[model samples]
Target: MGATPYSLVYGMDAVLPVELRIPSQRVMMEAGLPEFEWAQARYQELHMIDEKRLKVLYHVQRYQRLVEKAFKKKVRIRDVKKGDLVVKFDRAPVYDHRGKFRPNSLGPFIVNEVLFGKAVRLLDQNGETSTEPINLDQLKKYYA
Candidate 1:
């Protein structure tokens, strides 16, 4: 939720829990108010909570966009076209018969089709196309 837990639950910024044990300015101020007036104030705050929540939602979206832009600046954009050769990223390590370590990428799989710029369908070494498209992030261009 966009609103802070404290504000959502309390319909205002929550005073520190210690404020209840010790006396804080807010506690002391509210303490002097008659019970009926205090209840009325709380009811008013609750009625305006929707507007407060809207403000928080806008703030959260703005912050998220800022973070996204910062992240995109450091991203290495990869582009692939039909017929390009690429290697799939392997999640597990592979060992050769000679006990040598294998590279984390496998295959000079052929790019059979480029889909939506974000993913590509590949052709296996046998020239059969894979059923599912692989995300471009999981592939690197194959020079050979």
Candidate 2:
């Protein structure tokens, strides 16, 4: 997580603009070395680039798994079946205190078909069917 994008991709630390203006320790260290020796040292560093890339890959995969685990904790699994009655959720923001006028959800609609994973087709109370599929989150089981 502490890795910079340049380091992740290049397998080495970036030479900042500040370092160029005011010489850095690495530049100072390489200053006195012979040209052939410096070339040998650079080759060694390049040889280890693959190892650094592998380490970064491992870190990224671990982070992704942690995120997936945290996300799964808040998930609620909803299951519905054909012929089961369910109330469709109302998306409206309005709220009414009066019992007679307050209707937050629609129908006791019968489940007509269960579609691909979590989507369901519904038949309204008046025998009219909904053309579009509704997500499981928008439905709650109706009792009695």
Best by TM-score: 2
- The lDDT for every candidate, in the order shown, is 0.83, 0.85
Tens digits of per-residue lDDT for model 2 on 1-144? 999999999998888796555454576465786666766766666667778889999999999999999999998778788999999988777656774567879999999999997899999988998999999999999999
Cα shift from native, residue 31, model 2 (Å): 1.2
Q: Candidate 1: minimum summed lDDT over ten consecutive residues — where?
A: 93-102
User: What are the models' TM-scores?
Assistant: 0.54, 0.65
Q: Write the per-residue lDDT of candidate 1 for residues 1-144, one digit (tens) a residue.
A: 678988987898777887665445577577797666666766666667778899999999999999999999999988888888899998764556644465678899999988985988999989998999999999999997
Least well predicted 10-residue stretch by lDDT in candidate 2: 19-28
Off by over 4 Å in 1: 1-40, 47-55, 93-100, 124-128
Best by lDDT: 2
Residue 38, candidate 1: Cα error in Å is 4.3
